[model samples]
Target: MSNDNHITIYEHEILRIDRGEKRVSVNQLKALQEFYGESGVPYYSLIHNGVKFCEYVGVLQVGDTLIEILPKVDKNLTDSEASWRKVLIDMLHAVGLFNLQAPSSSNLKLNSNSILDLYFELFVKEVKYLLRQGLVKKYRKTEGNSTSLKGSLKFGKHISQNLVHQERFYIQHTVYDTTHELHAILYKVLKLLLRINTNQSIQGSLKSLELEFPEMPDLKITEATFNRLHLNRKTQGYHNAIEIARMLLLNYHPDVSKGSNHILALMFDMNLLWEQFVYVSLRKFKKGNTTITAQNTRNFWKTSKGSKSRMKPDIVLNIDKADCVVIDTKWKNIKNYNPSPEDLRQMFAYMKYYKAKKVALIYPGTDFSNSSGFYYDHDKYGAHEIGKEECSVISLPYNTDIRQWQKQIALDIYNWVEVNDESSVDC
Candidate 1:
């Protein structure tokens, strides 16, 4: 490939730099430094002749002039493969950009120019639907000086400040208002979307929506704001849409210093993405007397100075008040279909600490056969007798149809647990 300003590389693939060409410019270096400082994850790895890339799988702008480099797709996927498109869809869904209630059509394909393009397209669609229904409104408290004292009077402030003018008295009223939490959230979303690099259509749509929003100062929305929202018939429809917009805006942190030269790119770690997908999908199986928990943490070891170390299992199955099964999701290709020693040791710790009947290690890929023997027996694969507790390494296949894949995963898990639970009871 010739020395072009824009470059795209795949995941785990190294890009070599020519001896004469400048690889890392000063401005790119500064932007990268700032990105690392803010995100705390090294986006790229610099080596002697080239750079070893990491989790970020999107376009990155380097230098003050904003030269764009598109990172490589996953190590398993080729650039021209249709699977890359699926990966993009999964990425959007993982970040709550896609609506979960409306399942993605099996035949639907995105003609997006870029990831941000697709995001803005969907965002505009949802916003338009919301507008058709009219914006959500609530009774917000209004405080000001009133001549007739329409609401509760602040006698202390009224007497101190307005004693000279007996005509006006300071009062507060809880009036039915449209400019409440929902409008504040929507306003922030519009502002953040405008900052991103998008097409003319999206830009025009956002501007139109902006005019429709109430004239309120952008409010810093926190987790508390989401919790405080009362979801009845009126606000329930907008809940998911508002949340998706809120999350995207919150996660968006771009280098605005490059002015108009910088490209808008959002990247997600496959490791974290796989974990989140598994956790969310597993929740479907939570039936009577059973509960599913993700990122379940507990102190497994204690230091001599009284400090405690924690053990966090990715997914935990609590059956009848006991931690029955612990699962850990891995985002790597297993060699010879065997779990690595390090992964085994980690799962072993969970089994010991939680007294779990079984521990499962899940990976993402579809090469393996979905047969019964896929699960590793106790003595097999060097996971010999620590106890009667069983350990299984399962692969969750990545299919173009994500909904079907998720359903298969739920069934696999349910069956695995049902068989194991019966055997354990007999023992």
Candidate 2:
């Protein structure tokens, strides 16, 4: 590679010179060579921050002072990869990056934000319990002094001389106080900061691995295939990479704060999204398959007249090849909260425009019209509605029993795709 490809090295203190040799890894050496050059020595340049002393030199040694390199100033960083980066970090932590198997008694402790998030989760659980117990109720006395009405009766209770019939009660638990809201904001920010780095690493690794191992390769079942299989094992198991990097960060930078500023903070932390994407992508890849996401939109205009109003579809199937169909994931249950006309219309539009033979609007529940391992189809609009079409609003119960939602999310995506693929037909 040339000097153009060299990775610039930045000192901990901006533009500071390292007076002594520092041990560098083989990989780090390679990275530096690629950024600078084998023969070019690094030197301080006040105007450019740092530059090569000369072209085409030899390997660098310790005590060979190099000025810190400076990166270009970024102004629109709020709109940049910072958001996705946070998500990447979080994913890494979730997937065994943070000494996952170490004894709980280990001296390692989570940052303040992690502790705050833990507390917030606990707080939510407490609120749910309090709600279940019902809110405070007020009691009142009713008339009836024949026997002195020994104990007071509740309001709306008809007292017959001395005896009381029943009690009427009122309860209220919908409290959104400052304390609760603050906790929620704090929890979200902390969670985002914690997970973003891991998420990015997972995504970068997955993409790189996929490019190297195409799904539909034509090959004979021979030694080459066996070697490739072993390589796949190493590539998929990125636990070592995650652990090493995490250990380095935790050991070197113990004072860094891990918290997000706002919702955009979550965007910078792509850990959750990376996990969701990689899990879905790789599982399909492993099975020599492809997947798609569904898109939905609504319009109240005829095809010829354009639209008087518009409604965006909840989801659309974006996959290109293979049997085409559309499906959407909903965290809500369909039974308790029936789909509205808008929801049905949106789904129908997706089916009509996408030319999909079957459309599934999946909800998080185990109930449907037919069997439990369920599958069903219906044309709900009865041919009179503006955007009526064939649709299957199936309820697939989420495995809530699983303690780790991330693992369960991957499993759910794989199982759903496997069972519902067009080839299966019976899903």
Candidate 3:
């Protein structure tokens, strides 16, 4: 079994394998290379001697080692990996990935090495919560031979299969029990953690779950399975657990050939996460008749062959259902206090197409400031006057108290919008 050794690094940082440092074995490196090749190297870059981590922030377990790639948004992040890990966890909680309701953050040991243990603890708690509330029983169709006749019987199947066994009957019956897909997935996850989870604290809980959870048939999980799952008020509590299960089961890849170096990579696309985080914060803290939405799309160009190209801004704020404040989120640092030329052009295009006077680009930074400016009207002659349309390079400062930071996003946007366009709605 792989030990709980961890290699912690930030985005865009390189970790070289050597005896002087926490290094991977030859087989482990091969496994990493294999994963990189299979996943198209999106998470990290494979170099000759080491790997370069990228914008994807999460834990990747190779062999027994956990490579924790954390998000480094703040320029002044003087703290160690522990601080950033906590920040990532907090952001996840804020975005409703995992609820921080149970076993509060205060109770968790900040010194614990890998981020995986924290997630394991959360999953354990969620299952325990379900057990306490009592496992929900669902009606599942079971087809088999039984002595006692129940539901509708398949006469043909019974005659063919139960020919020698005169007392047996092959029939399709409906069973109302807790051995359903939801419990099955939870059981499967518990089984997984029981094998790979290194947290001594949760080992007993894992064993308990194994005993408590019903033995469910191995389910073939797919996106459609989750899509078809409709949670009523009674099953609403299972949402968090199901969500976590979706992440785990989907990302898991078992080593069938070797049966040892099974992989479980739970990485988040930092750009998407940042975009959703901002979008969720805006939605949560928005006050008034104003509305905020993400991925408000419009098809900009359609070819002669009817190939359509679409333009979708990350976020858009519509006021009184009148005007739009198109906002594009960049999960990057604006170190130069200047927006990229391509980005500025993108914002300009959005402004013209959306027919809005104001659009903004939001970036993560240490200081809250706006590099405000206007787009210049152009003619054949280069010299021109300022146009009425405007774009601002806005910075969202990082706060350890993520809730407060989220509220501040709305306030900042409200202040920015209302200050420029007085006709816009109030906060």
Judging by lDDT against the true structure, name the best candidate: 3
Highest TM-score among the candidates is held by which one? 3
lDDT (tens digit, per residue) of candidate 2 on 1-427: 1121222232121221233232333433333333343554233112122223221111122112111222111222232222222233344444433333333213333331222222223322332332333422223333332322234433333333213423322222232222322122223323323443222323343343334321332222322322333213323332232223222222221112222211110111122233343344333344344454423354546666764666443344334433455655443444645556565565566656666645565554443321112122445534433222345555543322322334544445445544543322122
- What are the Cα lDDT values of the candidates? 0.63, 0.34, 0.79
Ordered by lDDT, highest first, the candidates read 3, 1, 2
Model 3 residue 344 lDDT score: 89
Clashing pairs in 1: 9-72, 10-72, 10-73, 27-63, 28-63
lDDT of 1: 0.63
Model 1: per-residue lDDT, tens digit, 223-276? Answer: 777777777898876765676665666555655776534434456666777777
Per-prediction TM-score, please?
A: 0.68, 0.29, 0.87
For model 1, state the Cα shift of residue 110 in Å: 4.8
Order of the predicted models by TM-score, top scorer first: 3, 1, 2
Error of 1 at 196 (Å): 2.3
- Better-scoring candidate (TM-score), 1 or 2: 1
Model 2 weakest 10-residue run by lDDT: 260-269
Give one digit per residue, the lDDT tens place, for model 3 in 239-292. Answer: 878887888888887776677777889888888888888989988887687778
* Model 1 lowest lDDT segment of ten: 64-73
Q: Which parts of model 1 have CA positions greater than 4 angstroms off? A: 1-9, 13-29, 42-52, 56-82, 91-97, 100-111, 141-175, 220-233, 254-265, 279-293, 303-307, 316-325, 354-358, 369-390, 407-427
